[model samples]
Target chain A: MASTTLQGLPASPGIAVGRCWTVDRRRLRTPRRKVTEQEVETELDRLDVAIDLSVQQLDGVRAKFQASDGAEHLAIIDVHRAMLRDPSLVDEVRRLVRVERVNVEWAVKRAVRKIKGAFDADDEFFRERRSDVDYVGERIVKNLMGQGSDAAEMPPPGSIVVARDLSPADTALFFHDRRVAALVTDAGGVTSHTAIVARALEIPAVVGTGKASTSAERGDWLVVDGSHGLVVLNPSAAERAEYEAARVRQMEREAELTRLKDLPAETVDGVRLRMVGNIEFGEEVPGLLSHGGEGVGLYRTEFLFMGRSELPTEEDHYRDYRALLDAMGGRPVTVRTFDLGGDKLPSGQKDHSENPALGLRAVRYCLRHPDLFYAQLRAAVRAAAHGNLRIMFPMVSGVAEVRAAKWALAEAFEQVVAQGLPARMPPVGVMVELPSAAVVADRIAREVDFLSIGTNDLIQYAIGVDRQNMDVAYLYRPLHLAVLRMLKSVAEAARAAGISVSMCGEMAGEPLYTLVLLGLGLDELSMNGPSIPEVKRVIRGASAREGRELLDRILDLNTADDIEREVRAEMARRFPGLLEGGARVGPVSG
Target chain B: MGRLERSFVIVNSLGLHARPAAMVVQASNRFRCEIQFEKDGLQINAKSIMGVLTLAAARGASVLVICEGDDAEQAMAAIGKVFESGFGER
Candidate 1:
């Protein structure tokens, strides 16, 4: 067979080479024979047995994952279990079986279609639920047809599972043992249940690859480059060897990073920088600490307010912060107040402004809603007494917002004290994200104990380009001359005020910009847990003087492209093959 | 002795998604009462996950919850707490 390659959506980040094992999910044929009145009871009994089996199977899946970190994905299985016994669906199926006098299989098919009709909205969430209904219906129907037994043999370890699409149940059953090396599906976007579970399990997966299931046969040799969303079928010898080498290198790199888990992120010279993690959930604390995270730089508290009907109360805030502090075991945890508004408004609050990003959000939104802000402020001060805690305000425009936020914190502190509650004023800081904030960083620094530059928004606002908009996305460069200048100035201002400055942004994690950031004199780099080792590796190899020289050289560059090229060339010359795999693409272009 | 009625605003973002819908159904099934959710003039049995899901309530949407039977008050109280907590999500 000729070698062929298929491009797909990168659902997970890794590469795997293995023989393909195709999961056959052909649509079952429903026997639709009319039944006599006396036969209706028998049909109803069959439906009951099927629902019981389906629920049992889902429970099995849930029990298998209960001890693992895939707790979030387990909720989907529970939902499926509830749907299995849902009165609306069960009653509808039973009605068709009794009144329509049809076979249980056909009745299930009809009931499923009826249920799907109720979910025929154009919304993505509904679309997902519609598929869930279909999967549940199929499970019961399959059982009724005497096909509920465990049929397909498990694929051997390190086999790539290819399928047209996988139900959440199917994904849970097959991937539970962690035997399958990779996954490929002809359908599903990044947000699909299969994609989400694949990422959580850290399995290499390529999804939305049209015709992958049809093209690849069982036991066919395949290479799944999930990082690049490329799959090679019947790869030529050279192609196979290339991917195999890449896979080996990736594993080796991971092993090396794991070995650096205990090492400090200090340059060859004596200068040292704190490597921390920016996390939303306390559940992620163990993973962060394992990757050598010294502390929590940005504990995004806004997530506590998301997905719920009512605002989180002060006790809710206090409990969460205290737990996070205890998890860190006295390591600094900087909790940012609710940065609501714009795209992240709470339930029941709608943003009616013409331009939301530039409108009331972050500090502005919190100030306007003092009651909500005070709850968080009071929680932060109370949690400070338990462990190392710091409080930071986001999107501060300048000194006035800083002063206002500090005042609110003071009020909350006084109130807590008046109530005879445990409270301590945590060290405070402001996020220098807005251009106006960056311009007056000196004054803002004077009002706060430290400064953290949120480069993601700063670059977006400074460049005046929405990174999600493809046409303007190319202009969203981290090494842009303007962005670099702002960073340099912010760092200088923090230093002049005799305060520490950290960066908690996408740029802080990228190995390509480590030296430049080090040269800017950043005291800390807070990123996702996985990125800590690689960035720290770069920091450990280079000297601060060298970084300073590189920064000076890039500052003279005339364009973003030029600066990026210089940085890329410099990293390659220093680190050797560090930029070759995973998130990093190919070599720099002219 | 009589039916109980209450109005609620779906407060959770991603209003009444599958998890929350299941929560409402489970809570409603705890009492011996006929509970229904009415939104946009479409009423659905609160004890039925599918019926509750059919409401497709988005955040800020107003829903009229109706409970009636011998245990209507107990059923209303139990289901009201679920709605008030936003299904304990977010």
Candidate 2:
């Protein structure tokens, strides 16, 4: 057979070379037939028995997985269990059987379609729910037809499992034991339950391959390059050897990253920097800690305000912050207050401003809606009692905004104290994201406990380029002379103010810019968990003196291209085999 | 027999999504009561997850929960606690 290469979405990062284990999960066919009046009662009985059996099977699956590590995927099973007993579905099926005089399996199929119609909206969340409803319906139909539960067959260890589509249950069953070397599916996006489970299990997976299930047969040799979302079938011996070598290299890189986890992000010349993770939820804490995150530098609070119509209540804010603080276990967790009204706003609110990026957002939005802002502030102060919680206001354009935000925090602190609730005045900081804030960082630094440079926004605002615009994306260079100048000035201003300075941005995580950030005298660097070890490794090897000299050289450069080329060349010379891999480590933007 | 009705704002971040809907249904099923939910004039049986989900009551949307039966008071109290707890989510 000719070698066939399929491009797909990279669902998990790894590579596997093994024979395919094709899972032939054909869609269950629901036999549709009219039932006689005498058979109607029997059909209803059959429906009840089928629903009970389906619930029992889900319970069994849930019980089996409850004891396993990484049990986050088990929540899906609980939802499925609840859905099986849902009166809306069960009632609909019974009504269909009695009124339409159809067989139990046919009634279940129609009932599922009816229930799915409610979730037919073009929303990602609803789309996932629709799939859930379908799976539940399929399970009942299969049961009514006397087909056993859709438990997956155990594939031989080290086989790459290929499927047209696997329900969450099927994916859970296949990948539960961690024996499957890799997985390739014809259908499923990065957000699909299958993709999410595969990632949680850290298995090599390439999803949305379009035809991987049909193209590869059972026992066919396959190379699954999950990192690049490439699958090679019936590979030549040369290609197989090349992939095998790449797999080993990737394993070595992972091992090396794990080894660097416990080390501090300190320069060879004795300049120490705190390495932290930027996170949104408590669920990410374990992953962050595993990667040696000392603390959370940017705990974005905007997610609480998203996807919902109403503003999060004070209790909502309090619970979330308390959980995050407790998860960090006395390590500082910087919480950015709701940075809404620009691109992100609560549901039912629309941004009518022609240029929202420069419009009412962050501090401006908070100031305008004191009620909303107070709820979060009160929550922040109350949560500060539990652990080390630092409150930072985002998109502060000037010192006045910083002062106003501080006043609000003080009021919240007083209110909490007057009410006799546990509260503490968390250290407040300003996010120097706007160009205006960066320009007057000295003044803003004086009014805050610390300063965190949000380079993604600063770069966009300073360079006057919307990175999302394809034509202008190339101009969104982190090493632009203007961005470097702003960063240097901010670092100098924080030094002058006698306050700590940190950067929680894409630039902080990029290994290519590790030396440049070190040169800027940042006290902390916060990024995604996976990027922490690599950046720390880069920092541990380089000296602060060399970093300063590199910064000085780049500052003299004329353009972004010149600065990037100089930095790239310096990194290659200083750390051999660093810039060769073109892997993007963390998110390029928030 | 008791009849109780109360308005609740869906405060959870994800709104009355799948998990919350299940919670509502499970709570409604625990008592001998006829529970109905009304949102934007659309009334649905709170005992049905599908009915609760179809409401799609986003955060800030007001949902009127009505319980009527011999155990209406107990059912209302149980369901109210679930709503106030935000279904164990943000």
Candidate 3:
């Protein structure tokens, strides 16, 4: 059996046994500089045809919104429309066609290749704009006579796709092709659009498999366990059988959790924990509520600034903000102010720094750009009157930044009040992502009404490991004794200060840490929308008091290895072998 | 007019992701040069990261750079120095 270790984006759970089919870039046409006036005219005709067909396809996708998950994906049509009319691309293609007298295919490719070079020189927003340029080239090619955007990726029935990297267009192709079981890419992480689509499709996916093509292949015999991010490339027959059995067991377990979807996330011991969603887009609120979320723990506001030209207008913010509250049926929606730091900067403000992950972001960004911050704060307050409102400050390095953010919130509240609006101010809190906040949790928790542990960022900062860095990626242990100890200390401090403690990161949603988080005295757990029902099921079945014992025992453990084994053993005893290979330990039956 | 020259590897270790590429592109914006990079058989506009990564010059590989900007010689010298050291160890 050929065995290799690769990094990838794991989007789904369970393993699949499959064969390898290697598709390299050899099929791609290389540029040939050596053609006729007839070829140029033919290529131009193809471009025009591609433009027409793309317009029709865009309309088709727009009209079929109900068939899909309905997130206004047709917005690409506007981008394509702009590209179709771009004089630069058209002129360049014409120039290439005239110079080389190449066929339409070569002409279209030449123009695209040239533009890609120029576009890369542009800024982030323009970089994103390059995606539009790609569509333009794609349409030109298709019009010239070809298939859709996917480049020769048609898997037979019950097949898996493996690639070096997957563009968003590749994701669209997956939706187009029905036989694809799952896909693994050599690149991209949790935030990639491909991961989002895989989750939406409910298909098993593993991405960020470093050098994915080196190990897994389009037709490689393998089993992929996307849940824990494992891919056994070219498994033996016995391994395939084992993985198949494991998959069946997982499906059965997932079905059990689906049954619990209707059940509330209450303990048999009669403790009620408000399950919340850490949502990115306003569109996600519907699914969050459907999954029995009581509130939104972390409604990340950065998504609004992602694909825009400048600061989103107050009206745009208000419209979406109002929609979220209404979607949750007045459930509490916590809106964190824009966390535009070094890494997550909007295309306009381009805050490039040496180490952006530790640079100006979240609260610091708001303090610097107070006017933009105040507008969002004002809209969030207005949305507050409609639902349970909570303002969360992200990436707070110290108490002073917290104080500054609070001042901005108060000033925005004052403005709304001055405009003859009834003052419905939301409680303010800070995301305890930095170690300084944990060190001084007593003081910060005292100042804030609540503390939501952003364990993702917290773990990253605490261990000084960029979670994105695969080399040190293993050190990003949320269950590390220091992390757990910090969580415990912060939770204790928050409780002592009469404030609620919660977690709203990947760690919070994970089943292994669910009991520990609860036992650590957290009042809430916020996770992905789809993770809600299963986590809730775990809560409803277990004894929270017993969970506290497990948490306490695991908390003081010196090493993470010691704590993990203990927690797993405790979960195993409670679950009676229902928990397998750390399929997350809480309520394994569910 | 003298032109500046330099060769820098795409850093933040993401291989020409949106931000780092933008920084490199933005850096080139200041200089008025037809900066060029050659690795393997691919030769492309150095100012464009798309061209750079499409060439697939992985970490530690030496890329010969040429520039004809306002600071063409300076840019060439500066970028040449950067490439020699893999852009401060990339």
Scored by DockQ, the top model is 2
Poorest 10 consecutive residues of model 3 chain B by lDDT? B10-19
- Per-residue accuracy of model 1 over A1-590 as CA lDDT, tens digit each: 77888999999878888999999998888888999999989889888899998899887777767456465577788678888988778888889878888888998899889988888658677788888888899899889888876556899999999999998878877888899999999987877788889988999899999999999999999989888788889987777888788788778877878888888899999789999999998768988998999999999987778766678778778878887888898899999888879866987678888899998899999999988899899989999978899999999998888999999999999999999988899999999899999999988888899999999999999999999999989999989899999999999999999999999999999998999998999999999998899899999999999999999999998999889999999999999877876434321111
| Candidate 1 ranges beyond 4 A from true positions | A278-292, A299-331, A337-388, A394-401, A419-422, A433-446, A455-498, A528-530, A548-569, A579-590, B1-15, B38-41, B58-65, B70-88
| lDDT head-to-head 1 vs 3, winner | 1
The clash count for each model shown is: 3, 1, 52
Q: How do all the candidates rank in terms of lDDT, highest first? A: 1, 2, 3
DockQ of each: 0.39, 0.53, 0.02
Model 3, A1-590: lDDT tens digits are: 64544445567655555665444422344345445665567666766677677667655544543346434233334335445545456666777777767665677677776777665443444454455466567656655556644346466766777766554455565555455776776655664555656666666778777766775545567666677666677666666787777777777867776677667778888877888999887657767876777889988777766644456667556766777777778778888878777866775566667877777777777788776788798898887877778889888877887888888888888999899985578989999989999889998976889998889888888899987788989888888988988988998999899999888889878776667776886888999877887677677778789888888787668887888899878767766543554444221111
Cα error, residue A125 of model 3, in Å, equals 9.8
- What TM-score would every model get versus the actual structure? 0.83, 0.89, 0.57
Worst 10 residues of 1 chain A by lDDT: A581-590
The list of candidate 2 runs beyond 4 A from truth reads A28-40, A67-72, A96-101, A121-127, A149-153, A280-287, A306-311, A338-361, A395-401, A434-444, A460-477, A480-486, A556-559, A582-590
Model 3 — TM-score against the truth?
A: 0.57
For model 2, how does the per-residue alpha-carbon lDDT over A1-590 read when each residue is reduced to its tens digit?
77889989999888889999999878877788999999989988888898899888887666656354454467677678888888878887888878888888888788888888888558777777788888888888888778856545699999999998887778767766778999999977887777778888889899999999999999999998777788999988877887888787778877887888888878889999999999987778988999999999999888887765567789878988887777788899999998878766787687888899889998899999998999999999999988899999999879878888999999999999999999999999989899999999999988989999999999999999999999999999998888999999999999999999999989999999999988899999999998898899899999998999999999999999999999999999998888866343321111
Arranged by TM-score with the best first, the candidates are 2, 1, 3
